[model samples]
Target: MMNSRNFLDLEEVRMEVFSGKISRAYCYVLVKQGKIKAIRVGRKILIPVNEAARLLAEGVN
Candidate 1:
């Protein structure tokens, strides 16, 4: 399967990623916890493009 599709660094994700509203460290923790899907490219983390929406709609899976 193809990995790393075009993901929006959207405002909400940015807020969560940048502002400590959610905390980037926490996001990575979720990935490690298998709460959300993710992959690392070298030193960078990539969250799935649909992650925020999926989280909003379904939550924590």
Candidate 2:
């Protein structure tokens, strides 16, 4: 289980990481491709802040 404080939703990732340039579907693709790590809680997918930061630092391929 992830602490909410350390996680961001896909929407936040889309907006903050990709600056809303990427679609929500693309975020799912990253997860599926193992590019981003995520956990599914019920129907909600939670992405760790560190993962987002890593993506920012590493840039998306």
Give all candidates' CA lDDT scores. 0.60, 0.86
The alpha-carbon root-mean-square deviation between model 1 and the true structure, to one decimal in Å, is: 5.8
Quote model 1's TM-score. 0.58
The TM-score values for the models, in the order shown, are: 0.58, 0.86
For model 2, give the 10-residue run with minimal summed lDDT: 1-10
Candidate 2: regions farther than 4 A off:
1-4
Off by over 4 Å in 1: 1-5, 8-20
Which residue pairs show collisions in model 1?
none
lDDT of 2 by residue, 1-22 (tens): 2245889999988898889998
lDDT of 2: 0.86
RMSD of each: 5.8, 3.6
